[model samples]
Target: MSPQQKALILLEKQGNFKVGSRSIPTPGTGQLLVKVYSAALNPVDYKIQVDGIFVTHYPAVLGVDIAGIVEELGEGVENFREGDKVLAHGNFYMIDQGAFQQYTLAVATFTAKIPSSQSFDSAATVPLGVDTAVAGLYGKHLGAGITPPWAKIVNDHEPKKPIVILGGSSSVGSYTIQLARLSGFYPIITTASPSNEDLVKDYGATHFFDRHLSASQLMVAINKVTDSPIRIVYDAISLPETQSVGWGLLAQNGILVLTLPALVKEDEGKGRKAVHTIGSPHLPHNNQELFRSSWGMIEKWLLEGIIQPNNREILPNGLEGIIGGLERMRMEQVSGTKLVAHPQETK
Candidate 1:
């Protein structure tokens, strides 16, 4: 018989998540089988359980941010060896690739070694959030088509340009603020609760505002900061009100990047665009190369403190703790922190 491992399984569409036993999967070519130590919870996991979105299979596993030690490598994989501590972006559509299991397969392209100074719990907070930020900012088809800082293009940054990010304290939002700073966008304006102003500023937000401000108030506040066109508005929250705020702040020829589907309609006369980003590296967009390029730099970035992981709160009870964590996330209780679980500690 094949090896077995503990997994958080979703029984069916819109089903409950339960800790269960499942056969451990083997790595295919160019993949690594990882012994998961830390699995970070995201809002999408709860959304999948309640809305039955993104995932189509029954009895499925759903987690995207994984951190652990590499146990085995498939044929043609050379960048990593067994026992190397790594973080990977797991795919929600692939049951065996999900992070909710003790043993899961990770594509080598999307995996990066974690710095020795970082714990597995902290490293687990990076993968999905950073990828979503990178995808929405640099992806030609999936985002605003901005030039990545790592790209060899002559004009890689817009030091004179201004950008706005809603939900600056979120995992995705925090990463976006960091990347925006790296991309040389000046006056990186972001909105969050007043309590999280320092946290977002630490992530490189140049200016901060209370998120409770009305759309008109935000427009007035932003106008006082910059006269330059607001070319990119990254709405990480993408709620109806937040979308309205973003849409209102966008300049002519600007693009509003949304993590969720856009609720705000675009005005063709103004030449503004609303882009819905797909963060999955496995997707067949023009973004595969971009993801690979960014993944290659992830280790160096983490080691050099160029990209900081989110503040993480480790959950109790190993795999069993994830259910409660997801509930808290669904109820909007978690903020400014990632919730990490240890699958290997499961009973």
Candidate 2:
């Protein structure tokens, strides 16, 4: 019999998450078997339980951000080796690829070496949020069509532009602010509660505003920071009120990137557009080349402190602890921190 491991599985559509046992899956070609140390909770995890949106299979295992040690290498997998510390973009559609288990398979192209500077808990915060931010800002066909910092074609590094990010403390917004700075965007304005102002600034936001500000008030504050037309607004929240503020701030021909489906309709004659992004790298036409380009730089970026993980809040009770964490996220009680669970610690 194959060795078994503990997993949190949703038994049926829109069902409760329960801890159960499953065989540890073998790695396929260009994949690695990861012994998961830290698995991060995301809002979408609970949403999947309530809405039954992404996973199509019953008894689905769900989780997307994983940080762990590689335990075995599949044929032709050269980027990583057995025993290497790594972080990976886990896939929810496949039970073998999910992060909610003690051991799971990682597609090599979506994996990155975890540098010595970060803990497994910290690295667990990166995969989903980092991919979303990079794809939204740098993907040409899917995003704002901005040049990625790692692009080859003598890309401009000093555009000296201004960008506004709504929900600056959100995982996506925080990473966007950091990548914005790396791409040389100046006056990186963001909105969060006053309590997270310093947090966003530390993540490279040059200007911060209270998220509760009225639309006109936010506009007035943004105008004071830079007269430069806000050409790119990454609305991490994308709520109706937040979308309105982002749409109002966007310049002609600007792009408003949204994580959720767009609710605001574009004016008939306006050159502006709202793009709803599908950030999973496993999707068709996901631009694997573009992801590889950025994934290659992750180690150096983390080593040099160019990229930082979300503030981590380690959950108690190992694999069983994830349920409560997801509940907290669904209740909107978790703020400015990524909740991580240790599967190996499960009793």
lDDT of 2 by residue, 28-112 (tens): 9999999999999888899899998988998889999999999999999997888999999999999999999999999998899
What's each prediction's TM-score? 0.97, 0.97
**What is the C-alpha local distance difference test score of candidate 2?**
0.91
| Candidate 1 structure quality by residue, lDDT tens digits, 1-347 | 98889999999999788899999998999999999999999999999999989888888999999999999999999999999999999988899999999999999999999999898998999998998999999988889888898985446552478999999999999999999888888889999999999999999999999999999999999999998889999999999989999999999989999999988886558989999997789877548999999999999999999999999998999999999999999999988999999998898
Query: What are the lDDT figures for the candidates, one per model?
Result: 0.93, 0.91
Q: How many clashes (backbone N, Cα, C below 3 Å) per candidate?
A: 0, 0
RMSD of 1: 1.4
| Candidate 1 wrong stretches, greater than 4 Å | 153-159
